[model samples]
Target: MTTTPRIAIIGAGPAGLLCARVLQLRGIEVTVYDADTAVDSRDPGGTLDLHADSGQIALEDAGLLAAFSELARPEGQAKSRLDQHGTVLSSFVPEEGDLAAPEIDRGQLRIMLDQHVRPATVRWGHKLLSATSLGGGQHRVEFANGHSATVDLLIGADGAWSRVRPLLSEAVPQYSGVSFLDVRFDEVDRRHPGIAALVGDGHVFANDGDGRAIIAQRNSEGRVRGYLGLRTELDWAASAGVDLADTASVRRYLLAEYAGWAPELLPLITDSDGEYVNRPIHTLPAPLTWRHRPGVTLIGDAAHLMSPFGGFGANLAMLDGAELARAIAEEPSTDAAITRYESVMLPRSGELAVQANQAIARFFAPGQAPAPDHEAEHRRYQEGAAAYRR
Candidate 1:
């Protein structure tokens, strides 16, 4: 612990980037490797709300909160809950200038995080293959294309199928019995007016009161992303003759399942502006932990992956990055730092994972009850509506 340690982070994701950025600011040298060919190799995913206590704090620690605010959409916090018939059950509109949990497109957030890190800090296309412990608190990292690096510390931020995880735990990601068809529309205000009106200012969550669900969120620049969710086997689409590559066929297949829903919600699937892609939800087992090993650790989805049902995935990842970086920068010994990081992070993430898994199950549960606090929320909404009317 007397000498400076060479840290290697396997992933250029939000967690990995923020971790490396914080370390750099503290005069620590770190290298980040990612499988991505470039920053914009593909759409990073959907819109995400950076919670104040977690993701926002991470940006503040990394000196990027001001920059984040410039790109964030505060109005995107507007949320509406709906039933299968597309009737708004309740709505929550944020006060003007509320920043408690503003939303940003995932791609834009990634780009903002990327801009803050030092140039060449991330080596793209360095797809991780394996990590071998060299003993005496050292390890070697191997990449897919014959690249390798030996470092004093290795951090796994590589996500669900992390190559760096096996060195720390025997756990692997498991499918959560739900899948989604990701669809998006561009120039939504002009091209899809009805859908835009349905989505309103921010996001919409419409449940069938059974197992099916739809989540659509408004991203920056009038782009809206929608997920058509179903609880089914991993291969259900393939076996059900849903050909993802054929737009018309995919639309027909999805519409068949949603036949009884409101006509207003049909465009979310039929009017998708791009090709539909399938995403099977996956997560690590809840209440997971591993004995600490010197010179190795994990953060984000690499550690405690869970269902997006709880909407805590990205927030937890960024929080993990910021807290772990702080521990390393302050603790006197590497062992002490890892211990401190795990002590707080493990229990916290494990509990959230359990809650997230439960939320996912409840979302798919037959005839599930409204959220426990829905009655209170409904009253608040009624009061707000009356105030607006007055």
Candidate 2:
């Protein structure tokens, strides 16, 4: 007789939540532990696109694709690349009925996924403190809230700094020498007309070819979010006298750094509405892997964290969750399930992680021509997306 293992998943992000949902549908007992005090504890920042094969497949597996299609903005797939002077170097507007990779606000996607999972499936606010082996292929999971449980299988979907990763792999994410100063503009068409036009439908990219760039995306509401990216030290903001709390100072610093940039692009930096958030980019060394352990495994960023350049992170994470759930459901034994899951996930994510890191460096290459071939670059991304869909 096959014994079902007691499963604990550490995270409530899309990956963890979807994994739980899939497992539950198969009548498997799985609990997701997350640090968030509640579902709305934090703003799930930015937007994401789900490739048809990876992320979309995962949603299909969980029976959330129909719901997601209702919430997703298919028109938000429009994207453009511009020079420092706000010249549209290249643009892509999807043909009608194109659903290759529809864009969705991260928050909305979370809400959709959250709706499908069982109530109490996620133990919200239960921050993982540690996971200790109890021998006999059993483990104890302790939470910061003083709660504990023993499980026969544990999956770490806890993201970049996963507390559960130390039990399986020694690799930690390292700085990628780039920092993004996150800023937002609200009611864009009404409050910032020029910036709205500059951004257009989907996404806008303004790169100076010297490691300074602006990446902005339009969200569901009238809100637009962006990041002023720079190739600098991890402590660039703190060491360079840029106070995140002081919006005025932050804007001045960015303006000065981008002094020669076109006047039309000024609103992207000047018309900020709130405190600027400093995000230092980090990634695990590419092609990372771990020897299979008995009862512990990782998924998503916990397994392979990479820059967002390749736009593969979210889709890959969802794919990992879906595939892992299927592996567990079909395999004769838990160990066999895990082995099958990692065999596919590790290699797939590792390849994409390495590609993402390379893409970052190439996007922000130094001494780039003033008018880079954005059309070619956009085509490459489209091709890559198509391949990923397969």
Candidate 3:
């Protein structure tokens, strides 16, 4: 009888959960650790448009494609571009049967993946505090709650601030010089018809010549998730007295900044439902690569964290999980699996990271328009999406 390997996966996010699911299918014993107390401890944020090549393919590999299909919103694939004055610049609605990419709420995707994995596979409230090599192809992981576990293989899917990364590389994520003030409007269609019309069915991306802009998307339950982006220094936000936790204060600050902009864009800021979330964009250095170490590896944000400008972070993470799982299942030895996974993933993620950096530089630069040439930008996005699919 072949001895199954004992694997430890950090984080219960999509990458970690999907990795655990695939490994369990291969009869490997896996334990997933997450900091949250429960599956639904905190809201997992907004919706995601899972591209056919990356996110969708990863789900198919894990045997969750059908589950993802059931939860995906096809009608939410539409996109609209506008200026701050509310004039529609361009729009695209994929024809039926065009499975280019479909939108799924982040919460729904989580639930779908959660149901497919075995219960108790994930130990919640297990905040990872540190990890140390035990020598001879084993490692010890310490948790914040005075608990620890030893495993033969450790997979770090813990995301941007991962503890597992230091074991393999000395790199850290740096700010992208852009900050987003996230706002939301509930029951937008019913309560705020004008704003709802501005957003339409899918996403509304609008920008002005100035350094300020907005990207709003129609979320599940008639909620509109909007991001008011600004190109400013990292300390600029802190010095402005903009209370990130207070919605009213954020609204006031936004209005004051965009005082001369059109009123149509103001409602997205003023009529928000929840506290503003101040997201300071960060990314790993371009072409980030690490030396491979035996018995340890990384996936998802722990590997290549980049700006959302290219909208590939989650999709790439899911793909990394699937690829890593395949490597381990097919390899004859643990060391071989880690070696193959790193060899392929490093170059692939590095390419995407470079593209993400270019996108950020162009989109958020001063005096630049968000996706200046709509047709050209769409074509570029489609080409990248196609390459990933192929």
Candidate 4:
């Protein structure tokens, strides 16, 4: 008889939840723990383009592709590059019926994954505080709520600031010298017609001469999300005289910064109505690998945190979850499975981390001549198209 491992997955995000679902389907008993009080306790952030080999494959493995397709915005696969004056520089739209990396709201994706798991399989309020090895192929995990669990396997799907990472590696995420002020505009076409026209169906990228940029995306429900990118010190935001907590103040400050630029681009910041979120990008050094340890492993951002410049964070995380589950299903022992998983995952994630860091540096490179080699990117898009065709 095959032995089923008792696995504990931390974090209820896409990686962790999908890991649990995949393992359970393979006849393994899995439990998921998350810090949130409820599933919808926190906003799930912006939209993501589920990549073909990574995210889409994970969803297919979990048997959630149909539901994901229903929620995915396939028709929204368009991109535009705008100058500071809101002039369209370059624009590209996929042919109708194209399914290459269709975008999906983070909230809807989470809900779809949540519905597939059995009731009570996830303990919502269980925030992991620490983990310790108990020998005999078991580990003890302590939660913030004064609860603990002893399990044969522990998978850390927690994000960049994962509490579970310290057990395996001494590495921590380091600032990438770039910060983003997240902004949102509601009723885009109705309230901000000009901005809507600027951002069209998918995304718009506006660059300024002062090492600042604005990336805006048209999300579902006619809402638009914007990320005001600034290449500044970690504390530069405070010196900019903007109230980080107040949306209006943030909008005003952004408008002032881009005062001389295009008025059309200002609405993305000036007309934003939602709360401003501060995201200080961080990344781990390249070739981030750890020694093989029994009873514990990590996936997603916990394993390889990188800058979002390449837009591979979510896709890589989902791929990690899927690969790890596949390894566990193939091996007879937990130690063997984890070892096999890390063997393949370490090099793969390290390469991606390098690519992500390089992408960030190139984006901020002095003089904005066309971004690096489009060969790899074109290959990715083609693969995505093939997946859709399948």
Per-residue C-alpha lDDT of model 3 across residues 1-390, encoded as one tens digit per residue: 135677899988889988888887776768999999988889688888787767877887899988888778777778887777778877887666655567888888877777878888999999999989988778999999999988889999999999999999999999888888888788888888988988788888877766778988888888888898888888775699866666677777788888877887888888877778888888988788877777899999999999886677888888888888887888988888898888888898899889887887776665645444533544554566567656
State each model's CA lDDT, in order. 0.87, 0.86, 0.82, 0.81
User: Estimated TM-score per prediction?
Assistant: 0.94, 0.94, 0.94, 0.94
In terms of lDDT, the poorest run of 10 residues in model 3 is 368-377
In terms of lDDT, model 3 sits at: 0.82
lDDT of 1 by residue, 246-327 (tens): 9988888888889899988889988888899999999899989999999999999999999997567898899899888888
Lowest summed lDDT window (length 10), candidate 2:
369-378
Worst 10 residues of 1 by lDDT: 372-381
Clashing pairs in 1: none
Q: Global CA lDDT of candidate 1, please?
A: 0.87
- Ranking 3 against 4 by lDDT, winner: 3
In TM-score terms, candidate 1 sits at 0.94
Q: Candidate 2 regions off by >4 Å?
A: 369-390
Per-residue lDDT of model 2, residues 1-390, tens digit only? 078899999998989988998998888989899999887789788999887758888888898888998878877878888878877877788778877678899998887788788988889999999999787667899998999999999999999999989988899999998889888889999998887887777889889888899999988888899999999888776788988788888888899899899998877888877678888999999999999888888888899999998578998998899889988899987788989999999988999899899888887888553333434544555576567556
